[model samples]
Target: MYPGVNMDMEMQNVGSNGSEAAARQMATTTGNGEGHTHRGPQSAETGSLLQAQCNGGSVEMKSDRRVLALRGPQDSTICRMQKELKDVVCWKIPLWMLLLFLLLIMVAIVFITLALCPVFHQDVDEKFDPSTFNISRLFKGNFSLLDLPFSDDLLVPSSNQSRALSRDLQGKLTVVYSSSPALSRYFSKAEVHAFRNGSVVAEYRLTFLMPEQQEEQLRRFTLSREMVYNVLRQSLHQQEDHGTYIDPLSLTLV
Candidate 1:
């Protein structure tokens, strides 16, 4: 401790003591006593970790240099921005691309839906019609009066307008004017009158027998009714005539 006695050794000892003291002070200030201080900055730091001490490693005990560790606003801001930029650069591109791709897919789906909306149709007539099948008949001549094969099979009459009289004819004919399901009653009691050359013979009733469903027969009966009425009108003189409205037999389908 004498002035400059063993000067070099004393200086070396003092330097070591100061380094130990600074290390202890840093450990205390950082609150890193529990093994954390061992991982701190290396000996290359060369300066005191704490502020208020000047010459870096060692100058003289009392040098005039003032130690100040000041980070300006610009430097602090730049460090924070660098960390944030690194995070975004590492993870944002794929996420943004995924969002854009989803949006494009949704737009394409909407456009496709709009383009294909007008291609649907639904109006069909499902009723079975005889005209849909190709068959023709002439019922106004003497050939039709010959005893048809249908004479024996007709079930006499039916209940509920008409019932299971002819299972064979049920699906075969489109019965137009029927108050009953069985044509058996009409076939037995109805009459036939024929017309030729726009002139009809006087009305005569004939039982025309049929084995098959005859929509054509019903149409023929209707035509006969009209022709007979007109021929009768021609026969009577208007001054002496009283009108007779013959009731066309009403037929119904079951």
Candidate 2:
């Protein structure tokens, strides 16, 4: 009985030892599997972080390139020139318009002033006067002679002498010789004859007696129709019953 008991106890002890070793080996295998899983996740996270850093660096490089392009010298100069040109155009247009408006205003003022006031005026003292002339010889007789009494100072030849007549009857004149010293020294003669239809004498001959020595000068003298009209008009204006004033400057020849 004692030997059987000893063999059973030894078998029990050996089984117990084998079970404990198996349990320890299984725990070590489970611990190794957990460590491998943790390592796999950490490596994947590191790789992802590296890729993100590369993308960020590429974006920053692109932004730097864009900033460098905008800061170039030629582009900056062009922008400044465009700005200055716009400012000049904005100022110059109004300036030119203002100048033109001022010029137009000056022109208008000049025209208005000229129209309001004249620089020349007519004189009253230089009016024509013919109160002392005889004018009845134009319609009197067939050979009636009318005499004109002119001032001696006006008829005497002197320096700056200017004289005119209203007729050219030198070739048709009948020469009459007179011996009057007053007539020779002072007065000249002019004769006017009026005809009817180029045949008969209409009224008479009017004569102004002058010196015989002045006959050569009288032959060359001629007068315009305006002078004749002036004389007639002045004579008519100075009539005894009907006197009127006439402005000499108002007479126009043409």
Candidate 3:
């Protein structure tokens, strides 16, 4: 062989052997215990330069290096963050605290159900009882009977003149007076006066049937007109003496 050709071949073989040895050294130094590879600063720069020269361009090498540099640090940071989050989430809550939280949730649910559900609402409307409400107000001059619930059943006097007394002393009579226009035509002035004074000639007797064990029992009561008048007079006097009206139904007549 020619001396010049022999020198050229020797130089080429030395260059290839040097490149292979450098690659092997880099691979060995950058390997992790788990057999994964990482790039050290020196090895990464040298490898990129060598790759750029072999591939005939610096642009591809620079792009690849930038991508590797960004991907490696970002992925490692993200994985570490995920592991920390998992560790935090694995921590157990105390039994007492968990029960307390559940109890609070149950209470909230009950309150929401009560506020939003219509099933618990009362269906019966409140009724106005005339026995409990004002009754003496009807006797007042400016009072209108139209506002009363029992206005249709009451009778008003036609004339303001008193009636003559009956000759029969033992004969009992019924007298009713009301402010209702429909029944007023049937009443005399004397009857209206008696009603206002809480007195009437009529007497009444009441009876009650009560269930006792498996059988029913009868109880009788005899209420005279004078006794009824006395109770009414006393109730009216009490209403006048005190500013408050008493409920007639609350009185135990039996």
Number of the predicted model whose TM-score against the real structure is largest: 2
Query: Clashing residue pairs, candidate 3?
Result: 155-178, 156-184
Full candidate order by lDDT, most accurate first = 2, 1, 3
Residue 187 miss distance in model 2 (angstroms): 20
At residue 120, give the lDDT of candidate 3.
69
Candidate 1: list runs displaced more than 4 Å.
1-9, 16-22, 25-30, 33-136, 139-254
Per-residue lDDT over 5-40 for candidate 3, one digit per residue giving the tens place of the 0 to 100 score? 999999999999999999998877666532445556
- RMSD for all candidates, in order, please: 22.9, 26.9, 19.8
Residues 1-254, model 2: lDDT tens digits = 69999999999999999999999898889778986666665565554422123311321223223322123455557777666545533446654455567899999999988886654545553332333322221212232112322333323324121122213222222221112221222223434334222221222233443234444453334222343334534543443432222233333221
lDDT, residue 24, model 2: 87
Q: By TM-score, rank the candidates, best first.
A: 2, 3, 1
lDDT of 3 at 191: 18
- What is the overall TM-score of model 2 with all chains considered together? 0.20
Global CA lDDT of candidate 2, please? 0.39
User: How high is the CA lDDT of each candidate model?
Assistant: 0.38, 0.39, 0.36
Best-performing candidate as measured by lDDT:
2
Total backbone clashes of candidate 2, pairs 3 or more residues apart or in separate chains: 1
Worst 10 residues of 3 by lDDT: 136-145
Model 1: worst 10 consecutive residues (lDDT sum): 245-254
Put down candidate 1 lDDT per residue, 19-116, tens digits, no spaces.
99999898787775554546445532544343442322222322235544454566667777666545533345544465567899999999988777
Two-way lDDT contest, 2 vs 3, winner: 2
